[model samples]
Target chain A: MNDDALPPARAIEFWFDFGSNYSYLSMMRIEALATARNVRIVWRPFLLGPVFRQLGFENSPFVLQKEKGAYVWKDMERQCRKYGVALTRPSTFPRAALLALRVALYGANEPWIGAYCRKIMQLNFADDREIGLPEVVSEALGSLDLPAQHIIETAQSDANKLHLREQTEAAIRRGIFGAPTFFVGDEMFWGNDRLDDALDYCEAMSRRDR
Target chain B: MNDDALPPARAIEFWFDFGSNYSYLSMMRIEALATARNVRIVWRPFLLGPVFRQLGFENSPFVLQKEKGAYVWKDMERQCRKYGVALTRPSTFPRAALLALRVALYGANEPWIGAYCRKIMQLNFADDREIGLPEVVSEALGSLDLPAQHIIETAQSDANKLHLREQTEAAIRRGIFGAPTFFVGDEMFWGNDRLDDALDYCEAMSRRDR
Candidate 1:
């Protein structure tokens, strides 16, 4: 049923964290896959820090459970290879997503945001670049021909920071517990593998609605 | 790449926990999918208790993270409905897998094991039965025309019990951290969603080897 080879009428909300390796999987392939299926994707970038804090998790669940953490690193390597995405394990995991997410919130309506995200993901995963640096983010924006300096300044503005916070809260209230969560209308699908299922649901609902 | 339509020269290992809802999902769907794809599945039933305890956890991570716990239950219902597998949440989650797993170890080489497993899954999920009770498991075995009393008696024997323990340790050593993990060759894929992907790899490898 190669849903990706369809008309993009239905829309789905996609939530991701820059530091999430699994999220990198979705970010790498989601746009093209969704476009082929004819589904519209609304990228909603949010910080995982606040969400984890609210849940009383002092550390990433992966780090808390060493085995799961080990599996994730291995899984990321395997998945990246399978997906044809260049991947090099970053020196640090769960790199600061605040700055990247802030810029993302500011550019939600801009087409360059997607490319900017892919660049950040490539930096963190494929190139082992530290995404926490302001310069790294600035460079990502510059390459996209977007207003790098202006967007970076606005991203640091108190209002944009709060917006990212509120968005993270919305994700929590909406029952998201993992990265790469997709919502077709209000129904959510978690994980990179469920991308197709999420799009299928959106397409079916769009037809039913019309 | 309809792996299911190919020759059955490849084999994949299927790891499962009787008490896991997600495991039930793979238990219900894997056989038909594998047979159609001609992939042989070596069912590995194991206990998650020792694994969790060794990681210094006194509770299921699902239970520890309330939100993930709640989401898992809901996801199970949605997935069951989608898979057309009758589902009724058991009164207890992560019901003791020791007794069931011991019997599974005893029956690992028997042809009746798969049906016995399906029955146990139905009892736990679709019937809302107490799988922690020996009688419930006994009844599940009875339905499959197997030697319920003999199996139950031997399942409690020290040797069989130890086999179950050794199997779990092997799983941990192999870097398994979750239920329903699949392994094609040496590569592992976690979660029920990766079942098809694992099998596809197995088929591809088999073709390459030939």
Candidate 2:
């Protein structure tokens, strides 16, 4: 069907935290999959650190659950290989996502937001870069051919920080406890593997509307 | 290919605890898939309760992470609908699998082991019965045309008690952290969704041997 024949586009809300390996998988793969299925993507960036705290976790649940943590690392390696993406294990688990997330939401309206999200994840999961620093995020913006200083400044503002906090609170309200959660309308799909299911939900809606 | 032309049969070890929701999902579906793919199924019953305690968990991880816990219940419903299984959510989460497992392992040599397993899971997950009770398990065994008294008595015997303990230890030694963990020639796959991947691994080995 042509654009006019298509249903009113229902964009999938992708809720992701910067520190998640599976979120990296979803970020790298969601765009192409969503584009092919003609589902628009709404990239919602937030920190999982605060969310984890609510679960009484001192750190990543993976860190506490050692054997599953071992499997997670292996799963990431297998996934990176399958997706043909280079990944060097980050020496640190969950570098504070506060800075990256603030800037990501700040740029949420910019046309390059998706590109920006992909680059941030690649630098974290692939290059093992310290994305917690302002410099790394500045470098990420520069590479995207977007202005670095202004976006960085706005992201650093107190209002934007509060905005990011609100985004996180909203996520908690949505009953999201993990990163890379997706929404097709009010229906929730969690984890990177559920990406297709989210898209299928969108496609099913389109068919129903038609 | 005919049976004579095929390689020696390869069995996939299905390691599960009766209390696990995903294990119930796997138990409900594994046999048909394995049969169709010409792969043998090795039913290995063990307790995740002991395993979780070793990880410092007082209860199911699903219960600890309430939001994710909520998602898990919904996911179970979706999985059941998809698989054509009747799932009346158990009144209690993570019922003690000790009694059921010991009895299950005692029947490991019997021809009706798989059917017995499927029925026990249905009683736990579909009928909302308290599987921790010996009476419930006896009822399940009676329905299966098996001798309940002999099996339960043998399972409660000191030899069978030691056998079940050893199985749980072996699961830990094998690096299994969760229920419904599948092993196709020592390559481990976790969760019910991975059932297909495990079967594929066995089928590929069959092709390679041929």
For each candidate, give its TM-score against the true structure: 0.91, 0.90
State the weakest 10-residue window (summed lDDT) of model 1 chain A. A1-10
- Please write out the lDDT profile of model 2 over residues B1-210, one tens digit for every residue: 111122343888889999999999999888889888878887789989888887788888898778888899887787788789998988898888688899988887688888988888998899888888999889989998788998899999998888888888888887888899988776778888778877877888878878
The residue-by-residue lDDT of candidate 1 on A122-196, one tens digit each, is 999888887888989988888888778999999999988888878888888877887888887667788887787
- Model 1, residue pairs in steric clash: A3-A37, A4-A36, A4-A37, A5-A36, A7-A38, A8-A38, B4-B37
Sliding window of 10 residues with minimal summed lDDT for model 2 chain B? B1-10
lDDT for residue B186 in candidate 2, whole number 0-100: 61
Q: What is the Cα-based lDDT of residue A32 in candidate 1?
A: 92
Q: Score the docking of each candidate (DockQ).
A: 0.58, 0.63
Off by over 4 Å in 1: A1-9, B1-9
Docking class of 2: medium
lDDT of 2 by residue, A1-210 (tens): 111122243678889988998999999998889888878887789878888887778888788788999888877776687678788889988777678899988878678888999999999998999999899999999998888999999999998888888888888878988989988777788998788877887898878878
